[model samples]
Target chain A: MPEQNFPQGTDRRPFADGDGRGTRSDHQARPQGVTTVRRWSNWSLAALVVGVAGGTAALARTIPSHAASTTTTVVPTAGTTGAAAGTTGAAPASGTTGATTAPGASSAAPSAPKPIAVTSPSGVTTYVMPGTASGTAAGTPAGGVAGTGGTTYVARGDT
Target chain B: MTARTRTSAPALPDAWQDRGDGGPIGVAERPAIGTTARLAAWPAERLHDGAAAVDTVLDALDRQASRFRPDSELSQVQRSSGTVFLVSDGFAEVLDAALRAARWTGGLVDPTVGAALQALGYDRDFAAIDQDAPGAVPQGVPAPGWSVVALGGRLLERPAGVLLDLGATAKGLGADRAAAAAFRAAGGSGGVLVSLGGDLSVVGAPPRGGWPVAVVEDPDRADAPPSQVVRLGEGALATSSARCRTWRRGGRRLHHLVDPRTGDPAEGPWRTATVAARNCLTANAASTAVMVGGADGARWLEETGLPARLVSTDGSVHLFGGWPRSDEAPVDVSAGPSLSLAAASVGCRR
Candidate 1:
């Protein structure tokens, strides 16, 4: 789909009736041949305003489960985990969903839940999250996507 | 929407905490002092999938429900009196749910309160509300009940006199929508949990049992304990709190939990009521009702057959019927593996 460059009040239907100008007059609503940086700035600012007010209020988010030291897999985007207690899923060996626990396994009271180790694909920068677990790495592969990564997987009894 | 930071694909870890046993197993822990989470995952990228679902719904909300954008249908109706802007299913559903809640709450939680809320010091994000700005809440005359904002099979409403404040319900609605999307994306088998701020909903089960969740301290309470843990799965939960807002007037403190009868801060026994329903909106409506209905509200929720956990002003916890239960035995904080993909396969392209 091609984008459009609509300017302010581009529809000239208001002047079509010839209240102030006749239909034959060159009064159609259209922009001049030249464009100014100021116009783009206004458009950008308006978009930013809408984005912040409209998007952030409902956009994606995550936080530690304060009520429970629940294990969060922060499953890498596109990977869906389901009931594969023995990594029995047709997918990867992890076989977990939304970065959570699997079936038929004893729960381990690890200091911090172990984070699986996944090295970033080539050229995909790996960003380490500060102030979080340092084991079994979680999070997006790209560097600086803090919210994308899972907390480091800490072995049981090892904080 | 703050230009969402474009995140690249995430790298998966090499191993998870492993337990040799292989049946559907459930695990939980107290992340904070009070909050608890029980998790059952079959094995799919549930978190990322869930977040993706949230983003898609939020994108639609912007296009359909936004009043901030001048071109939005909401804004159009706001500008014209007695005019009904036929809206899409998504927008209409949100408005319908909001109105239903408004009427059900006896007008205490009205969307039209947007004007009242804006006139108050909360014109911006709660974070931006000035603490020292001195009490100067613009007095707003509460409008008619939601019945005044008509609705049928199609969109019908004169929004000029009534501002639709789906603020409280939007989160709940969004959570359900996102969870549904995630479930669909993941082929609709494994358990799914969608938590937005304080509102959350779940579907299916995790790997083994259900998803455990926690009710954390009021971001305002520095010394608040985190013992509050609720086992949540296959339903939704929400909590409303006024600890985040207060107005000082002649030694009395006013909060945001408003009561329509008096159009003032709610007088109540419980500070927070977390209700679980099939969807987040229902949970939210119940939570808001608790703040307004007070003791009666708690009873009302119990009567409605929805599971509820109400925390009183004194920190006592009341659990309703039908709430999920861990092993009536002591909850094991940890003793199981995160997930294993052996018998049950939870991760398949949805």
Candidate 2:
């Protein structure tokens, strides 16, 4: 439903593929246009350009990922691999999972984030797009008090 | 409501002795060049060793519990290879998990599709397999279901030649093991966290606050910074879905998360589901099972009383039982404040 805007140069699909960058038109700005760079001395100028490019590149990089992530909030997750599907570690003695959000959220419905599934045990994952991570699952711990059979989420040292 | 009291210091084996050995949550803490009386606690460098630890468990699983392993205990007892053998105990831990999950999802999370998965596409270890030549996907391969296998405490037998795929359950168990190791090594008196892939659990409060975690939307963006943050203290969380994996064979796209009923990758209303429990094993297993449950899966999760969040295929989030959104400030309140809050929030979830 949200895909109809197409923003600028997006290829029209059934939905906004959830890539999060809004539309594709904003994609090819060559990194430097979003911000301005006064050409400094030759060495300084080149450094400035690269630095500026690098920063923009970083921003540009996060933009789509964030966009895609935001979109993924709505996407089904199980065995799909791409974007967030990247793996953090092999099945481990030292594995770490994705970031943890808190419990008892104040009901705010912003756009959702979609995620890909990654099998850390093998370090190999199949992503939707070739470059994303593949993660297997996301956990949302319900709050308002631990119930029977459900282990209560206690803060460290509270017990 | 029953309250299980705990006050014992966690104990662990030698693998986590180093001062820096707690596990990762999302961007796993990787080891840095150190003057080592202690080792790095990061996730990458530990791959082989970690995999070895996990494989050690799996190998034993096959030897003791699997019906597919030719030389495993279950395998040896079977009258012949033609018979699908199902047995219990060690190997049954994984099977029991799969069976419980299958019942939870109404068979969407069946673990018996190993053979059909291979026949349709994925046959070898993910690392060793070659991609299929792109083409039309053939239809209707019956997924091998857990239903095909029968089991009890130490009893299990399956249909002849039922290849088993423990992909889902294995990860959860591995995460629990890894995190438990870290928690124990951390002395069980301080903050600790462990995460394998996206499955995670926390044992302490992070320096910034409760561990500020992010549930990544796409696996590709895994290394990319997380967008949503979670304030984790002492719990586990896992997300399950199939929004990636675009391998084509038989002229069709085949993804993972195969529906045991259809024997093909799932086509469901929900795309991702994250289940949070006391440990990664429960969270991981439950998340995988919810994928199999579809819409009803969420309701079932609510009743079972696990806190959960489900993202639908059409792009909707179904927050069941009011999962506490971990985006708030990681303020380190006093023990009194924490205890008071804990006491208050407890009855609320019910």
Task: Show model 1 residue runs off by greater than 4 Å.
Answer: A1-159, B1-49, B66-72, B106-108, B135-140, B220-225, B245-252, B322-350
TM-score of chain B of 1: 0.73
Docking quality of model 1: it rates as: incorrect
Q: What DockQ class does candidate 2 belong to?
A: incorrect
Candidate 1 chain B, poorest ten consecutive residues by summed lDDT: B28-37
What TM-scores do the predictions have?
Answer: 0.54, 0.51
DockQ of each: 0.01, 0.01
Model 2 C-alpha lDDT per residue in residues B249-277, reported as the tens digit of each score: 76666666676777767676877777667
Give me the candidate number with maximum TM-score: 1
Cα-based lDDT at residue A2, candidate 1: 25
Q: What is the per-residue lDDT of model 1 for residues B1-350, given as tens digits with 9 covering 90 to 100?
A: 11121143222212112221223322211111011111223333333443444444544544344444343345555655544555555555666667667766666566665555555444433333455555454564454455667654334544355665566566667656666676666566655555555566666653222344555536444365433443343456677765545655434566666665555567899877666666677777777777777887777666675655566888776756444232110112122111111221111211
